[model samples]
Target: MIELLQDAHFWVGVALVIFLGILGYAGVHKIAWKLLGERGLKVQAQLDEAGKLRAEAEALLVQIKAQREAAEKQAALMLETAKEDAIRLGAEAKVKLDEQIKRRAALAERKIATAQAQAEADVKAAAADLATQAAETVLAARIAGAKSDPLIDAAVKTLAQRLQ
Candidate 1:
């Protein structure tokens, strides 16, 4: 036992045990454990914060996607409305054009009727003049060397009655 007590390795081991006991009594291990626990809590808090930020980012992405879809729908509706308006305008223009064409055709027909009426009047007047001249020639040839005074008096009386 005396030889064991004088051993250098045993003395070193005893010294180490005494040092550890003194540290325990001084509360150094407790302080180290508390610091390690606080560090672990801080890391956990950071991880929770990161998770919250990631969730917020995902929510924002969903909101942006919804807004984009709404905008696309609005644009499509506007495009459809524009197409409808264009078609309506085209129909209205065609109606107006058809009305104008019909009006022009009616006007042309009226003008042609007036011209035909005028032409008929002119032809009738010419025919009447030619018939009167032919009758005058036949009368002059047939009554040659006849009683001119009596025939002239009778024709004047007949013309006066017809005029009235």
Candidate 2:
């Protein structure tokens, strides 16, 4: 037994036992366990924060999607309205153009009619002048020798009666 007690291996075993007894007496294991539990709690809190952020992100995504859909609908409506307006404006312009063309055509016809009437009046005046000159020549040839204050007086009396 003394030989075993004198062994270096036996003394190392005793030293190890004493060291473990000191650590247990001081409750070092409990302190270590407490620190590990606090670290775990911190990790849990971080995980909860991450979960909250994920939920917020998801909600934001949903809101953005809704907004995008609404914007698309509004854009489509605006486009439709613009197309309708364009069509209406085009129709109005066409109507106005047609009216203007008709007005212009009527004005042109009026001018042509006026010109024709004036031309006819001018032709009639020229024909009357020509007839008067022809009659004067015929009368002058027929009455070349016969002058006649009597004939002139008779013509004056007839013109006066016609005027009355």
TM-score of each: 0.58, 0.76
Mind giving the per-residue lDDT tens digits that candidate 1 earns over 51-157? 99999999999999999999999999999999999999999999999999999999999999999999998999788767666766676666665667776757855
Highest-lDDT candidate? 1
How many steric clashes between backbone atoms does each model show?
Answer: 0, 0
Question: What lDDT would each prediction earn against the true structure?
Answer: 0.88, 0.87
lDDT of 1 at 149: 76
Candidate 1 ranges with C-alpha deviation above 4 Å? 1-41, 87-92, 133-147, 150-164
Q: What's the CA RMSD of model 2 in angstroms?
A: 4.2
**Residue-level lDDT tens digits of model 2 in 1-164:** 99999999999999999999999999998998999999999999999999999999999999999999999999999999999999999999999999999999999999999999999999997887677667666665666657767776567556544533
Model 2: residues >4 Å from true position, as ranges? 1-21, 150-164
Model 1 earns a TM-score of 0.58
For model 2, the local distance difference test gives 0.87
